[model samples]
Target: MERVIVAGGGLAGVRTVEALRAQGYPGRLTLVGAEPHRPYDRPPLSKAVLRGELDDTTVDADWTALDCELLLGHRVTGLTDVLETTAGPLGFDGLVIATGASPIRLPGDGPQHVLRTIDDARALRADLRPGARVAVVGAGWIGAEVATAAAKAGCRVTVVEAADTPLAAAVGAEVGAKTAPWYAEAGVELRHGVKVASVERGGLELAGGGSIEADAVVTGIGVRPETSWLEGSDLTLDDGIAVDERLRTGRPGVFAVGDCAAWWSSTFRRRLRVEHWDTALNAPEVAAANLLGGERVYDPVPYFWSEQFGHMVQYAGHHPVADTMIWRGDPAAGGWAACWLTGDRLAAIVTVDRPRDLVQARRIIAAQKRIDRSALADPAIPVRDA
Candidate 1:
């Protein structure tokens, strides 16, 4: 049996192991992790875990119950042909890198927090008291969700973002401008188009002359690929481990997946790295297929979801050349769906509070079918049929 060594027991790594077993690959498997907890679901860490809806139930499958040798609370310092760990060196026929990502931390003292792991969420949740001032550094998804949770707990929340509008870079200003009113409705003070220069004893100084009083400041700017450990390992690391269409890392028996992998995407016709929960859940099956001698390529339609205030937002497909935008319903009225098109083909769809539209939008994007703009704009028409 070919021995398989999987690094970073995250969603991708766990799924790869399960996938390998399901494919009937009777190999020696070892899962390594820096975190002490068993490989758990991370999407909940930002949503339900922050809301205190779940605990360790976040894990997909129990390691002990599965009888897999798990190396938790230990960080893999170096990855040669073998791994140098605290226990001892281990060899393998194949390796999978799924270290995931780390939260962008603010430069400051102990008070500045970030919500990436369960511990980070626990610390932030304990401090959510009524009337306490919170300054969220970035207005991305994490900042938005944290602000919503803080506001619901009766805390005075102020979101400080460098961009003119939240998610301006991701969804573009057209859709971003339309989505701005939700923060105001949630009673969150949005301080857009300003940068936080420094952190003082109890507040954050802006690039401009003003400063905001903050009992707690959270830095949710963004996350980068956790590939620093592979610096001297001769692996191609460009933002992430550079992989081919087959998820191979150029080395003989190494693979990369999830947020830490920048693979050539045939759909986008470029190297792409998606940091969404759906990618983490979906990419490992492809990696597993290739590991078991099956020729498989991961050409998935990138998908993601976010919950803020009372809105459930979902996005499907890649919008590389999305130059035109069309709305299926009124944005002001709330429950609406919008599509970004490139040359008549659906590039991406952003659905707000419309679950059925999102499901239909996915089918439309996958089929590569062109729908009449007028027909798509009319909410009365079935999106799939259109």
Candidate 2:
């Protein structure tokens, strides 16, 4: 490819260029970023950035050495043979769509915030002063992390969740409920089985005919892929831009990765669109290889990590709904692990404050090995041995 134009200069887009160069694909590279700032790390936006532990979380890289044109603050409006950006149309021999996702917001408005960018985190942090009443909607990863930061800042933080427990959709009610007490321990009120009807001037209106008075409301329900610009294109778009195992879109010279791409995982035997840092970091290598005429299937045991309420939580592999959950240690204790098994075969694992279990489980899951359930349940037994 003579000119490879990458849209959405987030982690995936930046990594695409990096991988292209690393693979010795010498060509004209252009990175079009929607934000004015250069590509930066996003995981810290909720944790360190919101807590003022970090002034900036820009992705540490020397762009000068790479030699690529970066168009910041340029939003892509449409796509065809050429990308239609806010600046102008630019043609490409190869195109990479790494637009990522945008956070879902509440219906109405208050002093609302969503943690998706550095600026978003900064604004939320400013509002989260000592004694400021903050109501955070959703008890998912972003919600929990933001609540932790707010509580640490001495804000009166309350988390409202429509489900019965935190992370119900991800880990299920039984397993997710184990994290409920952590909110209280962090001095953040946990309001389960509650829904926000609307956000008003003072605070949030509850669906159950109640109101939460707060100085600020932060919504972390979820995010949708930023693929509206590709509406009229022939590219297959489902929950995200649908791509095959090779990360190639239906379009010949175009490919999608990161949060914007729902790629078929041969390993998991399904299509998955993961909105995590590891996917953003690793998927581009496969996408860039394919873009440069190499056959590399993008099948990986998905992994992600989160830090909330002074605990490090990590998960690996796709835990199928039907998989039987096996607990390694007592959840009542501080650290534990829950392993998902498909008839003794390790499918996935979720660990809280147990990095060793996560590390070992990742390898076991990747290898598709079967382990003794009895041994796995024994906390004394190492995961590697199991």
Candidate 3:
């Protein structure tokens, strides 16, 4: 490919450019970023940045060496053989769609906030003053992290989750309930099984005939792929831009990666749209290789980590609901891990403050190793041996 245009100048987009250059592709690379700022680390938006520990979370990259044309504050409106950007029509021999996803906002008129960008974090941080009433809707990763940061900022935080427990959709209700006490310990109210009907000027109206008074509301329901620009494209678009194991979008010279790509993972035996930093960091290498006529498969043991409420939560691999769950160590004691296995093969692992388990679990899953459930349950037993 003589020329390449990468849409969405986020982590994934930048990584794609870096990978292409690293693979010795001395082509005309163009990166279009909607944000005025360059690609930045997004994970810290809810933690360090929101807490005001850092002025900005801009990503550390050797941009001078990459030698790519960057189109900052440029939005891609549509796509065909050429990208229809606000700047104008830009043609490319190859295209990478890494538009990523946007946070889901709560319905109604209210001062609602989300932790998606540096600006968003700054806006939210300003509202999180000491004793400011902050009602966070949803108990997912973003919600939990925001709540933790707000609490640390001395805000009176109340997390409202629609499920019976926090992270029910992620780790299941049983395991999620184990973390309910964490909110209380942090001096944040955790309200479960509550749905927000609407957001008003000073608070959130509950569907269950109640209301929560808050100075500000933050919603972390989830994110939807930013693929509206590809609405009439010949490529398939489901929840995200559908791509094969090679990250190809059916259209020649077009590929999608990161949060916007729902790649069919042969390893997981299913299509997965992992919206995590690790995916954004690692998937580009494979996609870049494929863009250069290399048959590289993008099947990774999906991994993610979160820091909230004085705990480090890490998960590796995709664990289907049918997998058998085994707990290692006493979860009630704080530091422990839950291993998911399909028959004897390790499927996934979720650990809380157990870095060794996450490190070993990733290796076990990558190797597709069979585990001794009894031995794995013992905290003293090493995962490699188990």
Angstrom error of the Cα, residue 148, model 1: value is: 0.7
Q: Can you write out model 2's per-residue Cα lDDT over 136-224, one digit (the tens) per residue?
A: 99999999999999999999999999999999988888889999999999999999999999989999999989899999999999999
lDDT of 3: 0.91
- What is the descending lDDT order? 3, 2, 1
**Deviation in Å, model 2, residue 71 alpha carbon:** 0.8
RMSD of 3: 1.1
Error of 1 at 106 (Å): 2.3
lDDT of 1: 0.83
Report the lDDT tens digits of candidate 1 across residue range 51-116.
777766455575554446788887777788788766678888888889998887766553688887
TM-score for each of the candidates: 0.96, 0.98, 0.98
The lDDT of each candidate is: 0.83, 0.91, 0.91
Off by over 4 Å in 1: 62-65
Query: Model 2 clash pairs?
Result: none
In candidate 3, how many clashes are counted? Answer: 0
Query: What are the per-residue Cα lDDT tens digits for candidate 3 across 96-150?
Result: 9999999988888877998788899899989999989999999999999999999
Supply the TM-score for candidate 3: 0.98
Residue 106 in model 1: lDDT:
66
Query: Relative to the unseen true structure, what is the C-alpha lDDT of residue 325 in candidate 3, on a scale of 0 to 100?
Result: 88
